[model samples]
Target: MKHLSYLNKYFLKYKWRILPGVLFVIISNIFGVVPAQVIRNAYDLIVENAAIYRLYEGFDRQAIVYDIFSYSLFFFGALILFLYLLRGLFLFFMRQTIILMSRHIEYDMKNEIYAHYQKLSLGFYRRNNTGDLMNRATEDVNRVRMYVGPAIMYAFNTTVLFLLVIYFMFSVNATLAIYALLPLPVLVLAIYYVNTIINQKSEKIQEQLSRLSSFVQERFSGIRVMKSYVREAHAQTIFAEESNAYKTNSMGLVKVQAFFYPTMLLLVGISTILTIYIGGEQVIDGAITPGNIAEFIVYVNQLTFPVTMLGWVTTLIQRAAASQKRINEFLQLQPDINSGSQEIDLNGNISFKNVSFTYADTGIEAIKEVSFEIKQGQFVAIIGKTGSGKSTLANLLMRMYDPSSGDILIEGQALDKIDLHSYRSQIGFVPQEVFLFSDSIKNNIAFGLDAVTDEQVNQAAKDAAVYQNIIGFEQQFETMLGERGITLSGGQKQRVSIARALIKSPQMLIFDDCLSAVDTKTEEEILSNLGKLMKGRTSVLIAHRISTIKNADKILVLDNGRIIEEGTHEELLNSGKAYAEMYQNQLLEEENV
Candidate 1:
């Protein structure tokens, strides 16, 4: 119950549907034994003298028996027909209500997990892989649904019918009832032992499945690498290894189930055989009537199946419990970052005061006492060597991750004091690795806008200098891109990402070398267009090429984790330090060409 406590609200919300469904299940199981009950009456009529003395008063005794048998057969037939009709109707209600309720709850649980996953911090995502999280949201939620739907209903049905059948069997003949249950203790012990094994195996199988999914996800994402390196065979081997591991674990679990189910069935067979032998002897010795023996047989037949289903119900419970434990591991996690209560409009005045950060897992500092400022409507560039924390700095400003030390201020207010949503609404980001949905070019461009018209999309594309290229395609704006913009060239993808951010028209736009993919001519054309767009807005650029940031109003040169130089492009070159050397190297390469 504690493992499933997260779902208490949903259970309570749908109790109206569940209660009536359970009532239907109860009524169905109760009357399910009616056919067996009437079997006893049919036997009694044949085995004993007819009690209707008036009807046979002037008739032969055999004739009277014949008439009694005929009428009894009709009565039993009609009762069975009616009971079966009732059973079918009740089953319909149960399925429609309880099973349907599970589906609704299943839908809610997926939404619940998905919504919570959205709220979870970036750190949470960094800690968990996509495939594992996907497993929890989809497969694990389905396992929980099994516990509520068929397992709960059938478990309840088994218990109630078992009790009623036992009561009837004992009343008919106590000795016969006791003999029929001789294997009960053995079966219980076997179930306990087998379920323990199943529990361990079920969890292992789920883990292996997640790993297989993750392996495939990673390989597909890096398929270009695999193909370019001619390592397709190697990738196949890796996939086979993961798939084999999953299959082996699955087969092991199936083997356990294979042996356990038949053993339980054998026990049920013994129970049936014992009732037939003992009840037949009792009828011969006159300890009980033939009707009682007949009734005992029907009750034993009815009881054996629910008992057999106990093993399956137990398996379902264990699987659900295992899935619940896995799901709870994430559902109970508290995000590292929580939203602030204050709501403030931003004017893009940003200041990083003694800001520093160290990744929690690595314990290595990315930024060390680095401080900078960007006034409204300014165009600033960050230049650095590889692994020099340029992208990390941009990430901190985006609030994807927070600085470990010192504060960032927006318009004189502490960054944490402003509502996160409001602060983010004022900034648009195009990351180094551009991403686009598998959708039309127009939809990708207008991705972040609340309500954007086609004119807005076209304008943003034009501003990105990609409008002509897009229209050159067969579908123009309606042209579809594959996963991660696979159908588009690298330059086109970067421009589309730029268009997506530009469509938002935020006060501050951060471009993390998004123009790196384009040639020098196209980059110049985009930068010229961007200059006009940045007339009254702030822009931050992180780049490697000197030409990209040479016209920036201010440039910060980072070496290792420290800011080594800061100035306008000309002032940096005049300083004859790191920035000057970088400019000279670029000039030498161009001249050499």
Candidate 2:
């Protein structure tokens, strides 16, 4: 019930639809009861007593014809009219409510899931898979929608129909009705058992489905890597294993469901047989009228259908509940970093004061107590070997993850105090690996803004040295990039990413080895343009080569999550430390070439 309570707000919002649907159900049930009354009346009048034939004796022939026509017309016409009105109107409204509710629930659930994803720290995404998140956003939300619509409507209908049938049955013959319902307890217990199994199995099935989805997504995204390594067979074997696991779990659930429905029908069939035999005896003994026996049997049969439907509804509800729990858990996760009370005023200066960070999973500090400061309009460079925490430092500045201890300040305010969205808007990041959406180049470049003009997009492209490349294409800016911009080469993708960052016109720019893919000449040209771009902004460049950072105002050399050398390039070279060794090694390689 607590899990189901998540739907209460949506239910209230759409209660108008639900109310009409409920009214329709009630009207349908009332009309449904009329048929039972008609059966009883027909049995008593036409079968038991012979007085219905006496009306023809005293009537004129034409009048008798008229009377017969009227009687026949009234009985059949009324029955047909009520049946049509109840089934058509009631079913229509019920379907409409379900459709509306499903859409509303799907929209709201997806919105909430997306909002939660945005709030979560970067570490969460690092640990989770993109395909699993996509599944939650799409498939999981759809599961909730199914429950909001068909599952709720059918459950409500079954409950109301059952109660009405039971009421009518008891009214006809309490003793016999009670005897007929003797199997209900057993039926309910069986349904409960089936539902328990379904919930457990369905949860496992959903998990496996997520894994399979993740595998397919990863394989497709990394198809080139897989092919390059010739691991196609291995990938297929892994995918098949996941696919088989999903199939086995789904089939196991089906096996349980197979037994459940048959058991329910068998129990209900026995109960119906008992009702007829006992009711027939009572009728023969004159304890009950034939009409009463007929009505009781009709009502008992009515009860059976709802009971059967109720069992299926219970199973759906259990599966939906399990899905809801998984979705709700993700929705409930609190972001590790969020805006504090103080507001941010960006003047572009960034300061790291003894900052240290350790990822939750590894529990080893990725960045030690490193301190650094970049004044406004400074072009500072960070050079490091692999695993040197240079990228981690940039992540902290971007507020992707807060330091486990110590403070990072931008302008004069602590990073936490700044509104995350507003603060991030003022910063641009081009990661070591560039990611482009499958969209037009223009759209990708202008992604940060709500509205982008063609001129602004063109100018940004020109500034990033990608304008010539775009114009060379037939569609130019309108040309669609394939998935993750697969149509573009590495250098072209990097340039496009640079254009995207430049279009934001951020106050702080962090380029994490973004120029690594381009030739030295193009790199030099970009760096020159970037120098002009960084005139009134603070910039941090994370690079591997000496040429990339040699001209920076200050350079910090890092190794193993600690800064070993920090000074101007010439100062570091003269200091005769790790920086000199790296510079000399690169120079030696160049000379050999």
Candidate 3:
């Protein structure tokens, strides 16, 4: 309930509908109880008229009594039918108000969650899996919706119906009402015990299901790798293990649930028997009539569904509470990276002032006292071995993270102070691992822009050395890609990513080993094309190969999260240091190949 308090605002937001829905529940229950009273009156009328018919001796008197009984029965029956129909109409209105409000709240909540997901930092994603995130947004929200809609609706209905039925029963005979309701407390306790077990078991099953979903999604996404490794049998065995665990948990819940219905029916049966027995005693004592026994039975049965619903509603509330707790955990999170109010154009003069950063999740220092500068139009390249923090530098420049110590400036302005969206819009970043949506090649290339022409797409594709390959496809630029662009080869994926960056025509461009998949000749061609396009724009290239950055205005050699060498290509070649050795070793490797 503490966790569910977050929904109070939404309840208040739709109070108009909720209030009317509440009114309808009460009205329907009022009509609902009136039927039992109608039955009691009709029963009494028939008995009294039958007595009169028995006393009368003439055939005409008997026939008239029979007609009176028949007409009264018809009138009462029609009235009962009309009352039930009217009750059903109000129930319909109740659902229209409450259930419809739940749908609207669900939509708003999903959007809020998705929007919050986007606001979250990369670390949040790193610490959570996609499947759990998806389940919280979808499955959890749906559970909460059940609480808001059906559980709430049924709870109110049960309360109102119970009150009305009990009032009518007590009005007739207090002793009979008490005897009839004796079994209800035990039913509630049994339901409570069972629901607690169901709640615990349900959580376990939900967790296992999330794990199963994640395993399946990952396996399908990496099916190519699995096939190459021939691990289908192994994958199936693991999947079966997860599935068996899920089934075990589910069966545990089902076992407890198996007790739920039988206990409810048994208690209800006891209540009905008690009502008949007690009402008959009262009738024999002259405290009530035969019609009273009939009415008490109807009242007892009327309470049965609502009492059964008590258990169900409790389960729903528990599930909703659990889900809402999970949702609130994320909703309460404040993004580590906050966007600034300033929206300004970036000229792309970049400076890293003794910048140092450590990955919070891994606790690995990815940068250490790194200091460098790039003039607005100069091209700077960073070369490093594996784990040398080359990509970290690009991440810093893109403002994906802020430095643990010191600062970064863009156009002589603090990077974090610039509006994140506006700042990112001015820069083009191509990452080491390429990702493309399941969209057309043309749309993928022109992703960030509001509008683009085919000519622009073609030129960018040509510049990235992927135009010929795209043209070879049956649908050319219109060919829709598979997941992560599996339709393209690795080199084509990299080039398409490059084209996506190039199409932006940004003030700054950062390519983080984006050409790794292409051959040397194609890499050179793409670099040559980029040189022309990169004029008067600050460009930062992070790569492993020295050949990729040999012509840069400045080159920084990194090792173990520190810059060990800084010089021009010619100077580094003659320096007889780390850079020189790397270049000589790379040249020999090329020669050997």
Candidate 4:
């Protein structure tokens, strides 16, 4: 219930609608309860008039008395029908106001969660899986909507109807009202006991559903790997086990609900029986009339639905409370990184002052007190072996993370001081792991820009050396790719990713081992094209091959997260150090190939 307090702001936002909805509930119940009294009065009219007609059976005016009796009963019946139609109309208005408000709130809640998710740091994604995040925004929000819409509506309707019905019954005769309501206290206790169990079960079910969703999402995304490894049967077995567990949990909830509803109906049934028996005895004792007995019966039947809904509304609220708690867990988390207010052109000399970074999750130092400088228009190359922190440098430059110690500066301004969006907007980064969306090839190339001409996409593809491959397709640039660009070869995917970065026409370019999937000939051609385009723009190249970066103005050779050698290609080759050894080995490998 406390967790559900988060929705108070939304309630306040829609207060005007809610207030009208409450008014409709009250009006509708007033009409609803009055029908029972109308029917009671109509019955008493028939009973009283029939006795008069019997007394006049032998008189000459008996025919006139019968006609009058028939017309009065008809009027009362018509009034009851009219009252019920009015109740139905107000019920419709109630749904329109309150239920629609719930829907609007659900829409707002999902958008807010999605926007917050985008603001969170990469570390947040690493900690929470995608399925759990989706469940909170979608399924959990839906459960809360049940509380917002149906539960709130029925709770109000029930309370109003009960109060009105009880007032009428007690006004007629307190003995019958007392007897009819005696079973309700036990109903309240039953709901209180069942609500706690439902809350616990609902939370467990949501957690298990999230796990199942994650399993399915991962398996679908990696279906190729599973097939290549011939593990389809094994995957199926595991899926079956997970499905069975979900079923088992669902059945546990169903069992409690099974016990809940019948208990409610039994108490309602007891109330009805007591009403009939007690009202009959009072009629015989002359404390009340036969019409009074009929009225009590109508009241009991009128109260039947609202009493049953008490159990259902309790279930909905308990489940909603559990779901809101899960949603609050993420909504309450503040993002680890906060953006700065500074906005400026980011084209300048870049410097890292003794920068060091450690991955918080693995506790492994990826960058250790490394320092470097890149002038405004210099082409700088960083060559390293596997696990030497090449990609980490690219991530840091893109501001995906902040260094654990030291500082990064662009021109004279601190990197963190610059507005994050403004800084990243000027840089084109092609990651080591190429990922393209499931869209047309042209669209993937033009993805970073808000708008682009087809000619620009074509030119960028040519510059990345993927133009020939793309044109060979029947649809050319319009060819649609599968997930992660699976329709293309590994080399083509990397080339398309490079084209996407190039299409941005940014002030700085960072390519982190983007040419690994392509052959040496394609790599040389792409580098030649890049050289022409990178003129007067700061560029950082991280590579495993020496040939790709031999023409750069400055080359850095890293080993074990440290810059062991720094010089131009010629200087490093002559130094006979790690860079020289790497170059010699690559040359021999090329000759053998």
Against the unseen true structure, what C-alpha lDDT does each candidate score? Answer: 0.87, 0.84, 0.91, 0.90
Candidate 4 local Cα displacement, residue 81, angstroms: 1.1
Task: TM-score each candidate.
Answer: 0.96, 0.95, 0.98, 0.97
TM-score of 3: 0.98
What tens-digit string does per-residue lDDT give for candidate 1 at 349-459? 889899998988678799988899999988999999998999989888887788899998888888777788888887889999898999999999988977899899999
lDDT of 1 at 136: 88
lDDT of 2 at 477: 95
Query: What is candidate 1's CA lDDT for residue 58?
Result: 77
Estimate, for each residue in 198-218, the C-alpha lDDT of model 3 and write its tens digit. 778767877787788888878
What TM-score would candidate 2 get against the native? 0.95
Tens digits of lDDT, candidate 4, 102-199: 99989989998999899999889988988889889999999999999999999999999899999999999998999999998998898889988999
Clashing pairs in 3: none
Q: Candidate 1: which stretches are off by over 4 Å?
A: 49-61
The lowest-lDDT stretch of 10 consecutive residues in candidate 3 is 194-203
Residue pairs clashing in model 1 are none
Best-performing candidate as measured by TM-score: 3
Query: Which candidate would rank higher by TM-score, 1 or 3?
Result: 3
Q: Considering TM-score, where higher is better, how would the candidates rank from best to worst?
A: 3, 4, 1, 2
Q: What is the lDDT of candidate 1?
A: 0.87
